[model samples]
Target chain A: MRKKPALWGLHASPPGLLKYVLAALPFLVVVLVYLIASDLRHDVNHADKLLPGFGQMLDSLKDLALVPDQRTGKILLLADTLASLKRLLIGVVLASVFGLFLGVNMGLLPGFRALQLSFVTFFSMIPPLAILPILFISFGVGELAKIVLIFIGVFPVIARDIYLASTQVPREQVVKALTLGATQLGVIYRVVLPQILPRLLDTVRLALGPAWLFLIASEAIAATNGLGYRIFLVRRYLAMDIILPYVLWITFIGFSMDWLLRRYMRWRYPWYERGGN
Target chain B: MTDTLASKYQLVIQDVHKSYGEKKVLEDIDLTVRSGEFCTVVGPSGCGKSTLLRLILGQEDVSSGFIYIDGKPVGLPSTDRGIVYQRYSLFPHLSVLDNVILGQTLRIAPWSARSKRKAFVDEAMVYLERMRLAEHSHKLPSELSGGMQQRVAIAQALIAKPKILMMDEPFGALDPETREEMQIFILELWDASRFTVFFVTHDLEEALFLGSRIFVLSQFYTDQRGNGQQIRRGAKIVADHHLPKTPLSAETKRAPHFLDLMESIRRDGFNPAHLQHVDDFNLRHPDSFRTLSPGEGDSQSDRMPQLWDKSQ
Candidate 1:
């Protein structure tokens, strides 16, 4: 037989130090590209507003995060972080609660499913951003509207995910639970609920990206404080330094949220299969 | 006498019939499972054995007639009856210990369970020890072997002390060697516990080896309804035999009589061409009876002229 090329012949997941390096390669490339661009841009104009030097970004970060804002005596980064986190928390938590309730109940009880499946599906399909104006008008441009926007963006997705998860808890488990002396309510809350909780955490982790998107969009549109509002606010001055740091901060925050959820699920439900390595 | 009462055929199905729209599934199944009896049902594929099990489990309602458990009509699945499926025999999410304790935990409130946690675990441990799953109690179903998982499933079901335990091809997923080992293990468990089992399988040897009474369900039986209406044939118990109860081993499967019974069952119910008339079905169990109503259930019995003589 002819010798096949190594790469074309077979492949398996990279192991050991190679895996770590492979993971870091993209980040390394991104930083290298940006460094060269920043160096070139700064060489052209000493006070360039576009693509500020790395030192300038560090200075901006130190100023916003470490130093108190001259106007309000609050650290700008901390203030923005706190505000955005509060809105995200309120929105995501409420959405999760509502979604779990509706989704599981709908899945378990056919009558409830018949009543809500069509409505929930239709609601889920509606572009949440399209109704921002209506929400702002009705709930006001304050915390309510922002939180509602996040809730609207995320609940349907989580609901659908949770519905699918709960419904797929398997007929064998249901019958087994019943035969084990579980009442209808006991089967739902005890048997089915425990089985789907890990799935709930997983769905919530996936919703984080969209949750951030909705939070930022809402904040950018109308908020006086928050990472999105601050980023947009600094844009007029072409403050790429502040924008870049803030963008990185947001990415880091989203990454942390996902990691923390995964960790929690693993810790609490050791039997949960993360599926991906 | 407790012997007479215990052997009273506690589970009775009278003239049961089931259908899905125009397609009938189980027709005129008059089954009587004696109390403290291990009844194994064998059938051809697509012969409605699973449908019959579902009806008995009360997961699905019977289309006609009634099912009685200890003279009381059966409702939806309850702790009175338990099931072990071939594939999903155990909850994958729960630990072996939790799976067994779950039977007791369901009845007690969470507060009470908290107070009685030690007691529950202790009780569950007894069954685990019997199942040889004691050392693996804290592990999930995925961590165990297929036979071990099934043992845990049986322990979980038996923990509840159900009156009847239904196993739907519980050993179907095992390799042949493992299956034989499991058969012996189950027989041991049966000897110890004596919980009435309604075991269903497509394997005739499995039926003969595992059961005190074996019922053969098939769609190959002749029906009075002519071929004009495109009538979909439903599964019926064509032959019910009472086997000798003994302290048996899987090795008994190799005996001549065992193979002979297996062969006869295969020819009787598994063959497509060897269609036996409903009246001539070889139902020979002592407790077995023809409970079918007139016309529907070979009502005329021996009075009718022989359609096809069995004594060739």
Candidate 2:
């Protein structure tokens, strides 16, 4: 028999510390590369807007986060984040309510399924961005249009995912519930609804990416105050400092939402099997 | 006919037939169960025993004929009947206590349920204690062993105080030792509670050991439908036997007569080659009866004399 090398083959298992180091390696490499590139660019052009130095980026962050705007007396970063979060929150909440309603009903009731399945599937297929123009025209390019765009972009997908999850709950469970004296509505709301809630959180977490995409796209095209609006407004001057920080902030917020939802699901539904549906 | 009345019997099925389009599943089915009989049904795979159980549970409707429970036609599934499947009987997201209480909770309005929660919990705990799962009441179904999960499932079903309890291969997923233990446990519960039970399984030994009355439902039976390719014959209750309602024990399973009975059921129900003529079925139970259709009688056996003689 041949001697097996450690940490290099199919038979090899890396220790815990090594595994953590390996996971962080890629992130470290990316930062190192970016820092070197920024330094090199700054040496060639001190006034470079393409890749601002760390000090310059920090100064830009401090201004946007701490200093009030001269015209509006509001911190630019805080104001933009608040505006974007409001639209995102309202849009996502509305989408979740509608999605859960449609999905649970469609999954449980044959008649509701027959009436809605094909139509929702068709609507899901239509590119949400392609209808942005129509939405802007119909609802006007105000907060309503932007929120509607986000809602339209994510609801169908969430509903479809939730429907799939709800259907995966064994027919045995439903029959058992019925035999346990649950009425039709009782089975749907009490039995099916609770079982699918963790799945709902999961679907919402997945929807956040597209929700952010639609929100940013809508704000960039029309909004006067938002993270997306500021990023686009600063783009012409090639203000990489502000753009980079705003982009990182958005990523952080998205990550936190996903993490929070996952934690809540685990805490609330300790019985839920992740990735098992 | 009076003997088969729902008022006399706990459950009665008359000339029941079930099919999905042209694919027949159950045909000319007639059954009458007493209020406290532990009736076990054994059959080959796809013999429609589970389908029959489902029909009685009111989860699915029969294609033709009728089912009566206590003289009222069986409607959609309700608290009057309780079922425990081979698996997924307990709600996965609920703790054992909560699952047991679910039936009581669901029976009342939400507002009333909250006020009556303590009473439901107290009632559920009694059943859980009987199942010896009181210590694990707060644990989720996923946390329990297969046998323990099934015990919880039984507690969950029994808490509702259903008129009849339906178990569809409830012990099929357990290991042999656990299965035997569960068999004894259920027998104890049945003896104590005296709830009418309709248990289904493909395991012949299990059928013989668990049932006070055993029914063999098999598709491998001859009828006037003949052996033509176009003729589709569904499963029928080919045999019914009444076993002595003696005290249940594990040692009884190893007795010679028990093994012999198991062997005969295997031949009668599970063997596709050993087809029995519908007229010659061993319906020896006092409660057993059959309502044969015009085409299902022995007179039509003349058309397929060879098969009929071979079956005899």
* DockQ top scorer: 2
Give TM-scores for every candidate, taking all chains together and pairing residue i with residue i: 0.93, 0.95
Top TM-score model: 2
* Residue A158 in model 2: lDDT: 88
**When only chain A is evaluated, what TM-score does every model earn?**
0.94, 0.96
Instruction: Quote the lDDT for A155 in model 1.
Output: 100
TM-score of 2: 0.95
* lDDT tens per residue, model 1, B1-312: 223433476888876889999888898788788877999999999988989999989989998877888877899999899999987657767888999999889898877888888999999998899988789999988889999999999988888888999999899989999999899999888887688999999888888888999999998877565433376777889999998865577678788888888888888899988878777889877877665433334546535454633222
Off by over 4 Å in 1: A1-15, A274-277, B1-7, B226-229, B291-312
User: lDDT score, residue A60, model 1?
Assistant: 88
For model 1, how does the per-residue alpha-carbon lDDT over A56-148 read when each residue is reduced to its tens digit?
Answer: 899989999999999999999999999999999999999999999898998899999999999999999999999999999999999999999
Question: Which segments of candidate 2 are over 4 A away from where they belong?
Answer: A1-7, A275-277, B2-4, B225-230, B300-312
Q: Would candidate 2 be rated incorrect, acceptable, medium or high by CAPRI criteria?
A: medium
